[model samples]
Target chain A: MSKKIVIVGGGPAGTIVANLLTKKLKKEEASVTVIDKTGRHVYEPGLLYVTLSDQDPKGIVKDEKDILNKKVRLIVDEATKIDTKRKMVEMKSGNRFDYDYLIIATGARLCPEEVPGLKEAAYHFYTVDEALKLKDALEKFDKGKIVIGVGGVPYKCPPAPAEIACFLDYKLRKRKTRDKVEIHYLSPLPRIFPIESVDPIVNKIFEKEGIKYTTFFNVESVDPKRKEVHSLEGETIGYDLLILIPPHRGSKVIEDSGLGDRGGWVPTDRYTLKVKGYDDVYAIGDATDLPISKSGAAAHYEAKVVANNIASEIKGIESRDKYNGKVVCLCDAGNKAIYMIILQSPLVPDGSIVC
Target chain B: MSEEPKVDRLIDARNTFCPGPLMELIRAIKEAKVGEVIGVLSSDTGSKRDIPLWTSKAGHKLIGIYEKAGYAEIVVQKIK
Candidate 1:
């Protein structure tokens, strides 16, 4: 009997592994099935360019059919729950699929509702629509205080807030409104960039770019009527325009299925990418509670390791490939310079680099 | 063949972000004549590869790519 491997999610990690598995094993050897709600694969990082209206919104995504070749079977259904014990997956459309092995790559989702008055007052910079809205607000503003704050902790792309802050300086300057636009950046983290080496480089650029930033301000709530965001410590920052990086959580299906940790992220073996407490089950990408930057590049690397290991398991061979916690991010600090941040085995001693 | 392919539109997308450069190329292509070549200068790291990929995918021809000190100029001719 041919083995069945079901991958939950169609994000970068899921899509990559599905392609790899099909290419490695013949259809008669093992079959592959992918489950995802939306049949579109979005290049999420491109949304930032769309915000500036430099890119078309329609160009950011590709149809799932185009993403995965016809060789791969795609179930355009949302997985509602995964019963590891029974080795079965249930979908929202009331369909069930059995799998000999499972890979969960359902990435994180934003939950801006965690903070009161946020949805009404501020714009979350995660989606294409929100980014465009912020861009529109930027275009209309001639001058005023713009507060770009981090809602809480564990958000995607930790440096994105700083990038926006610096980019605002350039954007406003290009419009000859530099002197009028006062950009202030606030984040809950104790420092600008969590990596010690990276924080100073970012701070230097922030200082040179004239962006006023304050760290350790955990936003507690927002007051749209007053046009202010209040921190947990009762500190408040007034804004003419507000851009927020909202808190993120794992997918609802992962949380509902009791497969997630306290933060709704899946618990997996750091080196092997195997789901903790279960055999023949693995997790990758943003959904896994891995101590690494949740970025697309990182997910691509994780997919390679996961696919190789899974192929080994099917062939009854010992797998040698392991997921090294390495995350490399490239940032353009608004025409000044491009910097790269490299963090390797961050949970271990002395394993981070920033340039 | 003309050395420059009769450059018609010049897009100054330098210092802009990714997809920004690509978008500028697409916009210029849309406004230019079918055979006119559009040139875009971009500092985004992704543009060098992205522009070429997009040009091929859109059924257009990439005229040339010139790399400067900090940025690159990608030229494409709208084929269809």
Candidate 2:
């Protein structure tokens, strides 16, 4: 029997899973259709390099048609609602897709406005546009108190804030303005990183780069007009320039479909990558509230299991691979120090990063 | 037939994404001696244009580009 696999969102997880299926399964066995609104695949990890002036922003984006396999039918449309019970998806464009199996990998959507005045007060480097904007802003910035704020917990790319701090130091040094600038960073967690083995190493980096760090400082609000940010605990900090990683939520389609938690992140079985209570449906990448880092690398791992398991079921065989929540993060601390951390996570079973 | 330019180094960048292949080629070129032929295997669609552009910009010699199963082998030689 042939299968219709409809993958929503052509980000890392969807694109990789679609590629795996199209490459592994015969065209007669399955038809893969991937639907995404943007139809552009951004290598998000590379966005850091763009901010550092090491990589071109254009280099990080790949056309969806170029990355997805030729056999995979690509649709550039917004997935408005997913009718899980009906095994169908309703798109904003009014197209309907029926799926024997579905994979939701829409990833996170940044919500800077969640923090009062943050949308206007600070620059962000999460999206291609935001990153390019930050690059332009940095180029004009010479000497000032620079602040990198982690808006809240459960943001994408755990090491990005620290990396940005170090990269800024490196940049300032090159500009001969190191003495004129002060870099400060804050993490919602108690430490710089969740992994025990990686925390101390990251601290060494903070010390080496001379960047100040404050732990357990979850941002509560910002006063863009005053150039100040207040923590949840009421601690206030002033900055000349602020770069923030905003709080993010899962795809609205998942939330509208009532398949996600209050935070809008879908719940998936950590090991099998299957959406809870949805035997025919699976979720991967930042879209799933998996107990691991919400990163492209982790999505690559989860996609392997989802793709393989679907293939096995279609072939009437047993699946052998499962996701173990393993995440490998290469934290690029400027000055050629690339800190590496390998861990089994979301840091703890409760999915909280307990420093 | 003219003998194919001898490749002193071959980089299998297949399965590696954008910037991955380019970064690897850069490292190989840095380690390579002048006049050494370096061949980079990339599956990334962007490499065809990226590598050649980099080669020209970096003052390296681009020998030839060969298509193979599932990837392209971009051959270049290190110069001054």
Candidate 3:
């Protein structure tokens, strides 16, 4: 019988792993399977542009079937649970898949409901649907106070909120409503970006753009009717539209499988990408709460390391692939772009780098 | 005039971030002559689905796709 490899979550990490594995295995050696709930794969980073109505939403999303390797079985369903000991996964559709090795790539999801009144009042641009909704809202509103709030730290794409703020500034100006609409950026961190070194550059950009910046203002709750956001620091900001980057959490399946830490992210050897408790199971992307920012690029690099290690283990060889926690981010600084690089050691030690 | 030999090329983009693999595939295809086969190896969930769709719309033929240990290899025959 051929070796069966099952990958959960058809995001960047899972898909990348599946593709690489197919290249290594012959037709009779191994069979790869990928499972995802959605049929559409959206370019998540493009959401910032989508929210500003700068990019066509359709261009950012693609059909999942079109990307899968012909050899891999693409299963479209929700993964309800993982039975590591039994080496099987139970799906919401009541189908169970048995595997010799399992890779979890289910990325993070934004949970606005975690904060009171946020689900009802605020709009999010984390997903394709959310971005489209935000685009529509922004286009319809003539002139009003637009508040861009950073719900908490460790959100995916650290620079997204700031990028969106800058884009909104330009958008409002292009609409000739700059004088009427006020844009405010609220964050819990002391500076625009947590990394002290990068703050000087980011802070300068914020000032040059004329965006009102409030630091150390932790959002407590939101009142939709009053269009107000109350912070734990005893300050309130009122706005006609709220574009929020909500707190992110790990997959519920990972938490329920007992593989997650206190924050619900899978705990793994930062260098190995191996789940702490299970040898046959590995986690990648936002599913594993590594110290680095949870972005597609991080997932891609982590997947490379995990794939090599997993391949070595399968072949009865010593695994040598190790993650160095490298991260690269493309910050859209209004009209131009800034490419930032953050190494792993400094990030893990300081825990303030804007990855 | 003689017909150009169809070259079979496989481009692996698995585990590569956005715009990286896609951009590379476009460049590789452009360098190849018509009737040449270009295989893309991408595991970025988005690319697995996007490449074929884009290839078909761009007038290319998808030969086959297969998955190995951790990535997917998609073969495309450039027609235009």
Residue A138 local lDDT, model 3: 87
Candidate 3 Cα deviation (angstroms), residue A101: 1.1
Number of the candidate with higher lDDT, 1 or 2: 2
DockQ of each: 0.01, 0.01, 0.01
lDDT of 1 by residue, A10-55 (tens): 9988999999988877787789999989988888877766765388
| Tens-digit lDDT string for candidate 3 (A1-355) | 5788899988878888888887767767778899999867888888887877568878888877777778888999999898988999999999999998889898886778767888889898998788889899988887778898766444787667877887777777778888888888986554565444566776876787778888656576899999999875568899899987786778888778776654467777677788877777888998875655678878888888877776666666874877866676677755545434443322232222343
Instruction: Please identify model 1 stretches exceeding 4 Å from their true place.
Output: A336-354, B1-80
Model 3 per-residue lDDT tens digits across residues B1-80: 33332437655444434223444455456456788887776655455665666566556777766665656676778676
Residue A34 shift from truth in candidate 1, angstroms:
1.2
Q: List the residue pairs that clash in candidate 2.
A: A291-A346
Q: For model 2, what is the alpha-carbon lDDT of residue B43?
A: 64
lDDT of 2 by residue, A1-355 (tens): 6799999999999999999999878988999999989999999988888888779878999899999989999999999999988999999989999999999999998888778888888898998899989999998888889999777656787778878887788888888888888998976544665444467877887787788987656687988888998885447889999998987878788889999865688878767788989899999999986545678888888899888889988888975687755555666766755544444443212332222
Q: Give residue A310's error in model 1 in angstroms.
A: 0.6
Please state the error at residue A103 of candidate 2 in Å: 0.4
> If both were scored by TM-score, which would come out higher, candidate 1 or candidate 3?
1
Instruction: Tell me the spans in candidate 3 whose CA falls farther than 4 Å from its real position.
Output: A336-355, B1-80
Kindly report which residue pairs in candidate 1 clash with one another: none
lDDT tens per residue, model 1, B1-73? 3354456766655543212456446535644677888888776666787678667655789989887787777
Model 1: how large is the Cα RMSD against the reference?
Answer: 19.9
TM-score of each: 0.79, 0.78, 0.76
